[model samples]
Target: MQEINSIYPTDKKECYKLILAQLKSLLEDEPYVIPNLSNTSALLNGALTDINWVGFYLLHNNELLLGPFQGKTACVHIPIGKGVCGTAVQKDAIQLVKDVHEFPGHIACDSASRSEIVIPIHYNGQIVGVLDIDSPFIARFDSVDQEGLSELVNILEIACDWANVR
Candidate 1:
């Protein structure tokens, strides 16, 4: 239960580095999934600016089920290849949307979310879930976010025990 109230570094790379370090410290020796994801969502929600939602959706029985999150209530289930989160798993890549309104199949779980970034989380060479973040500002996410969050997801993939998640 560490308190993180310091301002993030102005430089994006430095900020991500700090975030990664914090994530490592927070997740160390904690191999359980739910609590890990819960803390992870809280960490990102507090660290990132202008984001309205920070959460995870896990793959189960061929669909994505809502997992731990930090935000207003969200969509409970999403089919594969459906929305940004699903599409990330569908394509097995990161989905960085500058504007959710512009995406053809965007799901509006929250109307305030104008942008989103979803990174597919992999385990044992298979997609297990997604690290999903949303912002209220249009074009809030970009390449820097994609890269930084991708690294964060990588940390989670390594630190958590995916086999025990479901």
Candidate 2:
């Protein structure tokens, strides 16, 4: 792969395509999960606009534990089937909330966040964590963002070695 470019396209879908490619290049030779996740969070935090937080919540001891993240201080633990991150793990599906205040049992890690997206990260047929992003603007995340971010998580699932990640 060529050098990862900083020039992001104005088109969302096209930008996502480039972001996926950039992620691949960034993780090309790395296998350890922690550093990979750290860089992934930083990459997304920088690449995506209109977002206040981007991070990972790893499943450990039947709950979600805070992992590498780029944003303000966040809640350290979230139970499964609870908040958006936990619900994503419980449902094993992406959660896209246009208005977090409207979502029952929402966890407000950052009071500035109004919208959020969470995608379950699976490895070897079991969920290991979630990729979460938060936005300060209501409805900041849409289907396009979900699709693109999902692809990013897919790459993370296959690229990192999750053994002993907890």
Candidate 3:
């Protein structure tokens, strides 16, 4: 097992680079989806600062179902086009909200979450799930976050065994 530092780099870009490297090391040769996602969530939660939630919401039966996560209790199901996670799936793009309260149709799983970023996860050319992260501070996520998290999701898209997951 590879070990990671609890301390995260101050630079957002470098932090994501390190986190992505750690993810690659963690997911290598791991064919299982649940465990891989579980570790991935935990890794993000640990590596990131000022984030209250980190997890995956997988698509199933035309709806988003809760998957592995590291945070307080969260909503179990969300319809496509509904909440941040659902919106990412519906639009097939990233939803980086500076203020959740300002977002139309925002779902507050945690009232403490003021900002959020949701990245759609695709596998085999099909939308499979989303990587959702939430922060307590408003405007916590910016363009740098959008790019970094998007790249992180890209790593997950390639690392996981989507055939078994879907």
Candidate 4:
């Protein structure tokens, strides 16, 4: 996997769109893992600003365990209703937190994360994981990001729904 630490002149929305397109191109059959897109964590971390961590925490055993990420070590376990990711799962919705500190029962996976966005990913009609993104700046993910990211993940779930593992 490649590691990207910075963003160039490429447009954020367009870049992410292209990225999603590329990920779609790599799709195979059901329950298949995204081999080339495995490193998306790094790309997202670099492309977006004020973000210290970018990745997912899969739902397993009724808990959210850390998955692939591009940042420092993070908390491995988070129960539903514990943190942003948990809340997203519990509500089956997307959470855009401006300040992690102000969020009740916030899990300090990374002390540097001030803002966060968690989008639930469903597989075979079941909540399987979340597309989590964090930022150091407050209110980093706005409506544009929320809508775009949500739509992007939706496309992923539809095309790659057969298998969104890893």
- Between prediction 2 and prediction 4, the one with superior TM-score is 2
Give the Cα lDDT of each candidate. Answer: 0.91, 0.90, 0.91, 0.74
Give the per-residue Cα lDDT of candidate 3 at 84: 86
Where does candidate 1 stray beyond 4 Å?
Answer: 1-6
When summed lDDT is taken over every stretch of 10 residues in candidate 1, the lowest stretch is 1-10
Q: How do the residues 1-166 of candidate 4 rate in per-residue lDDT, one tens digit apiece?
A: 6544333335667766765665555553433434323555655666666678888788778898877777888889989888899999999999999888999989887787899999998877778788898888888888878876787677667765335353
Candidate 3 clashes between residue pairs 3 or more apart in a chain or in different chains? none
User: Which 10 consecutive positions of candidate 3 have the poorest summed lDDT?
Assistant: 1-10
How well does each candidate superpose onto the true structure, as a TM-score? 0.95, 0.94, 0.94, 0.82
Per-residue CA lDDT of candidate 3, range 24-126, in tens?
A: 8998988788998899999988888899999999999999999999999999999999988888999998999999999999999999999999999999899
**Cα-lDDT of candidate 4:** 0.74
Best by lDDT: 1
**Clashes within 3 Å, all models in order:** 0, 0, 0, 4
Candidate 4: 10-residue stretch with minimal lDDT: 28-37
Candidate numbers, best TM-score first, in rank order: 1, 3, 2, 4
lDDT of 2 by residue, 1-166 (tens): 5433356777889989988998999999899899999999988887788899999999999999999999999999999999899899988889999999999999888889999999999988999999999999999999999899888988898889887686
Clashing pairs in 4: 31-162, 31-163, 50-136, 51-135
